[model samples]
Target: MSTVQLYAWGPALGAPSIDPKCVIIEAYLRLLNIEYTVVQTNDPQASPTGELPLIKDGNVWVAGVDRILTHFSMRNQDANASLTPEQRAVYLAYNAMIQENLYDCMLYTWYADMTNFVKSIRPTYAKLLSFPGRYLVPVQLKNSAKARLAKYNVEITSDDTTLPQNEKEEMKELQRTGWHHMYKLARETYASLDAQLGSQKYMFGDSPTTLDCIVFGYLALHLYPDLPHGRLRHILTHEYPRLAEFCERFNAAYFSREHDVSTPAEDVPSLWKVLVNNPRGFFSNVKDDIVSYMGTDAPKEKSTAQIDFERKRIWSIAGGVTCLLAYIIWNGIISVEFDGEQGDFESWDEYDQEEVDEEL
Candidate 1:
């Protein structure tokens, strides 16, 4: 017996409902022939964190797509459904890219840009920023973010309630464009998926892997756009027919149940593609955002821990103090690059890599 249960959500009415997270979990479970149950994520107030897509397995509970997929992957590993070693590496890489790069972009759109977004989504929520302690929202809004960040990690008190009008305006501005960046991320991520799917039917191969499910759920929310005024007509379903086909196939085969209230399985295909509509041109454009999303906030060369290292390097280099550290910091870097077309260099001895660094 499979201990797995899926939590799902969708539109309140009108549109055919689909939750990508639910579909991804459903796909992997069925493909692996694992047993599981499904439920709606319960909530009296609709918070950004999750009202849907939180699953409970006995005492162990996890929310969001990544955590849910990880839980199920740990449990199921049949040969037909298990990821190949090579596929496993790629899956991890892709999933990481989605979480760090794509999700950062998504949240920046959802949280940072979504004042208007929040308002647009307000109907979905039972209440507004009644999210405990409202005053700090304005404080975080008006000043240079650095000043407000001082408040971060500290508990908010009732005294923080009032804010200057300007900051309130700023907060509203951030909310307006939240969806734009996500639209950018969806295009970029979808392109990556299309390229891979065009190469092979499944994300990893003919058989779907745990990675595919992770990629599928979040993308579905954006592509399907069951929400009014958010549907992505820009990502023409014609551009990548195969990916659309994959989504449709999953919807039809896995979710087409009569009793399901959220999204009818019959409409899964259109709903699936509609969520993450475009990718080819979109993914290629956000090079800076992607790199920034991956990197830490510390300076590229200097860090909080080694502030003195830069000062020491500058003094040594300028004042004719020929210290060993200066040379080590500026003199050299070691790198190896390979092109697949040349030949396979899987082993160390084959490539002759003698690695030495100038010691400080």
Candidate 2:
């Protein structure tokens, strides 16, 4: 059988991938002792679902961590095979809690929190992209994060002086209320995880399972990155030291090798190589990225103001490009040059005189 190919976001800050989902998938593969070559890419479009941590084995392609696990299950490689039905039920409950509550907290800290977004998140993603993507992707990710949190009534807001005094007060109150709720959720979730872990090495007995991988994935991101506003990290480290210790041990066991197993250097594609091999695909991905960045992936019922704003933004970009091209042409930076020899000509008076003398 051919070695499986794992496509994920590039690693950063001691994590296999900046994305927690990617980290979970990588850890699961390592835990299973699967022979897979990691293919690092910044483009989420590589996956059919337009997400990361995809796996390609022979003719089969799996886009998500859950679906990949299901794919593995068909081959009798289930990670939670040893778990009792009761334990599996527990795992599902905790998993949903983590995904619903803790994941939102992570998103808020990394993207919605302006301090962390500007200081850590944006810079991290910026390094992974090329050209305009460096400027665009971070903002898109931030907007997506905010949109995801909107349903939870969580938001990050800055004081808008343009608004009326009462409106400004309302916004400020909403910001405080939202973050307070988020912090509370994070604290409660950590406490529950810590209580469940107790002194056990793994979540369930000696062997690590899918739940362990998921827990570690979230914990590692919180513990590893040195974010400016690090509220989630603060809660985990100070309030839930057991969870913190679990993350440390987990990291040492799976990720502390001299040669990193998750991202093999040779298997990773270079930007130039991707462009050369599939230029059309590469630009198509870029266009998709730009459209996504513009928040086209948000809910279909956009406000009229938002629609107008997007239209103006597109027109502005087009106008800017047009102006740039016109400037280049007008300044002779891009001009037509003739190679034909030049013919010398006399003034009209001299030509007339010469003609008269010839006639005489």
Candidate 3:
């Protein structure tokens, strides 16, 4: 009976759907009775691996939600072990593809409501949110965010959920007029999916599989029930009942863990949009990205050219898996040295030995 350390995340942005991998992880761990700790992950900026959720199993470090969940199933004892050998491999491959595809569509569209997002989902966020509006979620973001948040709160939550007449009408107009392009992209994708789910139980079947796990989380956290804040107001729980039901069922089954936000604040997950596809391949959040969010001009030079090398390397490794087999074969993950300078940990555990690693 060994245990592993799972560094998880529940973000404050109140992205109700949040992380699919985490949802998968939660269901697997509980079903398998795998003794593990459910904790928030570090801000990617401060983590050894820039993304989460990360799982530490002895000397091995696995990142990304899908990667970590497979790590759990592979090495840990599976009480029921429903996945066949072939099935497991296929699930891994498909999960990666779908997750990336969804994100590509999502990130591009998320910024459209970059400002209006505050006014849309105020009720769900009104609780468990920390950080004041003044310094919260960056600056240029504050004013719009506050107005939107306040408006959203007023709409969804009234003494009896009776949003004011003017308030309702105003929100409706904003949806049709303001930031509509972004809204269309973000909402239409789900509208199609929602349409497709007319009678099915899951995406492909009655029984849930890996794909179901991903879809459930993605839709719940991002789609379903509502649009991103204020931009896509046309789509709401009242707008799409079946899809909304799907989201509710998925969350009830998967994200059932107590997301008690206060303790060990570091465990919560926060996603930052980075300009990773830069020409020179320098990765940075760029001061401008947060300047509006933070209401301050970015430092004269806040580029992460130096610190971003590792991030670039990791991303390059991931991107090359498709066509650059040779690059992967020769430019492997191990170390190479011209002159012998002490470098490269023999294993992932040496740098950060987890107390949980001992149990596992």
Ranking by lDDT: 2, 3, 1
In order of appearance, the predictions have TM-scores of 0.47, 0.70, 0.49
Better of 2 and 3 by lDDT: 2
lDDT digits (tens) for residues 1-360 of candidate 3: 445566654544344324445655655555455666655532332234455566555556666665665665576544225666875675565566546544433332232232233333332332323322112222222233333434223121110112224756645644543334434555665666565466777554465555566665565445543443432324535566676677677667655665333232344222211211121121122233333333343333223541242244334434433333343235542244444765542232322322211000
Give the total clashing residue pairs for model 1.
Answer: 19
> Model 2, range 1-360, lDDT digits (tens) per residue?
778888888888667678888888888888898878787777765554557777877777777777888898788888999999999999999988987877788887775565566557767887887644565556556666767889877764321112223645544644663767778888899989888888899999778899999999887788778886677778888888899989988888887752233553353333433333444454455565446535433246445644554565455545544664466457643344455775432222321211110000
lDDT of 3 at 310: 27
Worst 10 residues of 3 by lDDT: 273-282
Choose the strongest candidate by lDDT. 2
Q: Candidate 1 local accuracy as lDDT? A: 0.43
Write model 1 residue lDDT over 229-310, tens digit each, in one string: 3334236265556666776665565556533323222212221121123222222222322342233454443343234423
Minimal lDDT window, size 10, model 2: 351-360
Pull out the clashing pairs in model 2: none
Task: Give the total clashing residue pairs for model 3.
Answer: 20
- Cα deviation at 342, candidate 2, in Å, is 40
